[model samples]
Target: MKSRKTRVLAVLLVLSLLGAACSKSSDTKEKKKTEDTDYEKHSMETKESTEETTTETTEPSQRDTSVRPVSTPTPTPEPIPMLTAADIQSMNNNNALIVYNEVGNVSTIVGRFFHRPVADEDDAINAIKGVQELLGLQTGYFPFAVYGERFQGYTVYTYQQMKEDVTVTNATLKIVLDQEGYPCMLQSSLASNLDYTPSSPTITEKDAEEIVLNNMGSGYRVLSEYTMTTVYTDYAKAQHCYQVYTNSLIDNASFDMPYIVHFISLDGEYINAYPTAFLPTDPFADYGQDSYFKDMVPTDYSFTINVNGNQVDITIPISKNNVDGKYYLCDPDRKIIVADYYSFEFKGQLKFDTQDDPNSFDAAHMVNYYYYTQAYDFYKEFNIESTDGFGMPILILDGYCDESGRAIKNCCNMGIQYGWSVFAATDGYSFGHSLDLVGHEYTHGVTFYSKQGVQYYNEYGAINEAYSDIMGNIMEMYMGETSDTEWAIGERSGDECRSMSYPYKHYQPMYVGDLYYISTSPLSYLSGLDDKGGVHDNSSLLSHMCYYLYMNGMSLEDLTWFFLASIEMQTPNADYDDFYAIFVASARMTGHEEIIPLLSDYWESTGLKGPREQTAENTTLEGYERINIPFYSAKVGAYCVVEVYSVALGGRYLYTTMQWDGIATFLAPADGTWFLIGITEFSDASLSTKVSEKWLNHDLTAWTDDPNDLGYIVFESGKITTFPTYQ
Candidate 1:
């Protein structure tokens, strides 16, 4: 995640309308007008001179006027339009639905496709191809890679998509099957419009590398091993670009962001660059065959550590290499290893040396040992072994630093390079001390290995960040909360970085069009904008949605498993809509369909259905159901204060919220007469007051100091009639 520094955010005051791309050409009529005027002046002068010199006047020409017949031109015939997501949805059975990306490719398809069980890999591929043809997906979607796995009693087949021979970044087609291997649902992020004229790059691979290096400047070196030319879609247009992987030589200096990915067009034009670090931000080390785990002695190390100035004792399971007679900071049973800076640099055995020092690097390792184990145990309950589900060792680099020996304050999952590994650097205090942060980093690995995972940018990156934050908080809760409360991350570090329950407190968006919402509309995957297109900033919308689920009776465990299943159903280029579909599929798959209604309500409330608009409705609402009422104002920054007054409570205001977006959410407190009062800056505009169910029980002091004293006129004569009695 980006550095969680507190600051005020500029509101998205106005909505922008999107139109088709077009070009404008102006006719040069001004020059012609000047020439014509000059000629007219000369002609008039010559006429007068001729009249004075010759004294002869030519007879006025007789005017002739005749109506002419006009011919109509036939209009050109338009090209046959290919099937779109809407068209495909209309043609398919109601049970199966497909969602297309901005580029018109089927990003996700969730539901049963085949009438019967798929036979094998060949059957799955053929079934997908036939579906593509039936849906009129004109692009070529050949399977470049295919694999099968089992989870939650379901057998799943995953196919990576490619165009011609070039790889499509983060594109995949997943075929899920029930226990008997029958096809259940399909998901994809394949490219479309493959008929574009192809041309070879003017710049060679070496030239592309040099261009990227020059653009990246000094103190940065490209990791040539990870560089590859792939097809990336931007603004619905696909182009071949080189994905250059580079990192900063200095860590945490804020000059060159680490794990920077530069997308250079194949023709060598620089497109965009940004850090893919999992905190604000890999293959395999098979140590199982080594003597370390084979001949290791298991032990439990106990230590007293300071957490928010309070001493707490904890125990973590670890192992000692009997062959080397050194204790390693690892739990062999859980397949986790905590490597120190020295061990990572020298590639030596990560030996645990000390246990009593509270401020030493060993203490940091112990902290990671405890939390990583907790996060592992949390996932293990869902039958997931590790990040890869293959018992791969979860490597945690404790006391990690740059080559210059400067301790970085940040901790990022280095899984992009080293599979299933997290490298953290500490300055004054250790990030290992924060459970949510550690779990946040750990979940990054989980997202990396998720079935369709996702690329780390734009809306996809925001979802990635939200997964870590949500699961991190869940993991913190699973391990038993200490200094920090639920739904808030980073409170243990003295600064409440983000609040899942109230995202607005941190200037993060709670809905799609909320204050900090970032637009990925054109679908530029490599946009190097702020916070990676607000990946960390807009992530709260999803996290708060999960929080809403938790508040509306979804158990944490149920939410956890459901989210894990949803991630399995996701695509690499998924946005909010794609996620909504995936989430619905997961709800049914996890046997929690009861939550779908509330989830849908949350979706609409969060603006996933589109921007909030005014609608006609009864003044009164039933029970705890929330309603959005839009109020009109002639100016921006207009205030609409909504209050709930209970006669049972001495006719006093029970709750109030100052809404600026015009939409107000209301909930009835009890059974009796409740007055809904609306105080608005615009008295002429028809408006209604509301106290959103979300803000009903929470403290309203943050919204305003006694909204009744704001001295604003009541909406439509102030007093909305009695609300229907709700149990």
Candidate 2:
């Protein structure tokens, strides 16, 4: 019902994290930090399976009063014996369980407990062990937690098939079985024929950490252990006999590097790491090419501006690469590649000019804005120089058509891009209409650039889609949408596409357990456009998780930081688990452990689980306060928009609302006074209001007449002012 269209819209009117009703301390005082906040009853426990995420919670809302409760942890069920290899043979019905399936050269195995009287985890362990013995994987390295609940539902477990723990070139293993003890499938893969050896680590854990830190050159906090029961070695490479585990941090504030791994040699030598920083130096720097026309957006320098008469350097070099041609390519600027698909009109005589094709003219606008906005977000949001943190020029193949368009299918509506560097979009008339959607595509360029590349079919493919959705929605939330917009893709449909808050409302799952099918085939990817390997659809899982975190007080800046910083920790085909483990480690590195509970709760709500896990259950955001900002205009029915931004974790647009009621009420992001302003107008351009005594004339005194009072905000003549209450 919220999909009901609003005739008028407003934008960029913003207030500080705490809305109108809040008053400043007027005196310095420290705030409290929590190892665990009393967030009981607020965690997302969804009551309905059909609920939408944007308007839903993860945990259920109502209790089933009819059900009996004699709480005793259900007596831990009865203890069952761990089975042996011979025990599994007695149960095998000669089913051809799927062997290891290779994904990006990483093999995975699957099995199902198809028999009646279901078996438990112990039985599953015995079955998998026997199966592995049959496949001759005993010599290979299995996961340290072979019996851990790696996957949800039907007693599934996964172990990485490491060719060599040191310089791993290939790894894979996964098994799915039910309680019935029937083996469903088993998968494992490794491409390297390189010999591997298990060795004893001579280097002390403390020494190895120091060696890795010294070789890597800063921006890392190390874990205590060598991260192994025994030393792991990749005999294929020069570096062998090393310790492998995610980097941990005791103090995380200054932590800012991407690689989640450290391959430390047992002999105190440096082998190889998973991701080296993607800080490719700018190649467009002067190598004796100084050709500047007028208004050229520099791909290489910072533009200076006087903010409140204070010189503030903002980096935005307007491009002189705006050439009116069949397709203008930024040559010397190798990082930026703009392929104008075509700009011709069929009006009697053929024309190759963009002016002739009105749509084509719009295309140029869309792509240019794409570059500009993305540059702004990457830099301003995460201090990321460009699409690639290393400042890679965005590659855009634009002017892709709408009605009967030809080119990449997923790139158009689903935001599912296929190629690396190259990004595609229909002119503003088709797909590029939504600024955030275009931002979404270009962000894929960032992710691809960061991942070095991405897979477009499996979970990696799904992650690609999810990242696009996450960034796109953020752009739309804080930067794009005038009013509260649905976390949907493209500019075409209304309330008809994927929903972020309520993915279920749009027929998508918010967790891995809800995946469409366990086994997959090429048909899933090749099945015409939208459902590419269920990439677009299944992506709602991560997207929903992303949105949930944002809703539960995770600022855009932190989310962006969490995302951008966590990139190097991923494989070309990383899944939710990969994200989970790395996120916990990285959050600790950044000293954001307080929010880990929030992140962990959302992750588990979606059926993914991990350690140092924190839970955030904001059923109704109970503890957070609110300010009902009031507004007035000589112009009746003037759309009033408000944005509440939080600076606690760097600046982030935490809440927004647009209405004709001349009022916008919002949950204060923190415990303090909030500032209100309209940074931009409906035209989507900055609406500047100089900061002076006149701007601060609005009332900020809090009403303490009632002990059980929240707060209120009022605006006058376009400036924020206090007014009367409604309650």
The model with the greatest TM-score is 1
Q: Compose the digit string of candidate 2's lDDT tens values, residues 87-115.
A: 43334432221211222221222223223
Model 2, residue 596: C-alpha shift (Å): 2.9
Model 1 ranges with Cα > 4 A deviation: 1-96, 134-140, 163-167, 178-182, 193-201, 233-239, 248-257, 277-292, 342-361, 416-420, 451-453, 483-485, 519-528, 611-727
Please report the TM-score between candidate 2 and the true structure: 0.39
Highest lDDT: give the candidate number: 1
C-alpha lDDT (0 to 100) for residue 83 of candidate 1: 36
Tell me the lDDT of model 1 at 240: 71
lDDT of each: 0.53, 0.38
Q: Which residue runs of candidate 2 sit more than 4 Å off their true CA positions?
A: 1-192, 195-338, 342-360, 363-372, 375-381, 401-420, 491-496, 512-530, 609-727
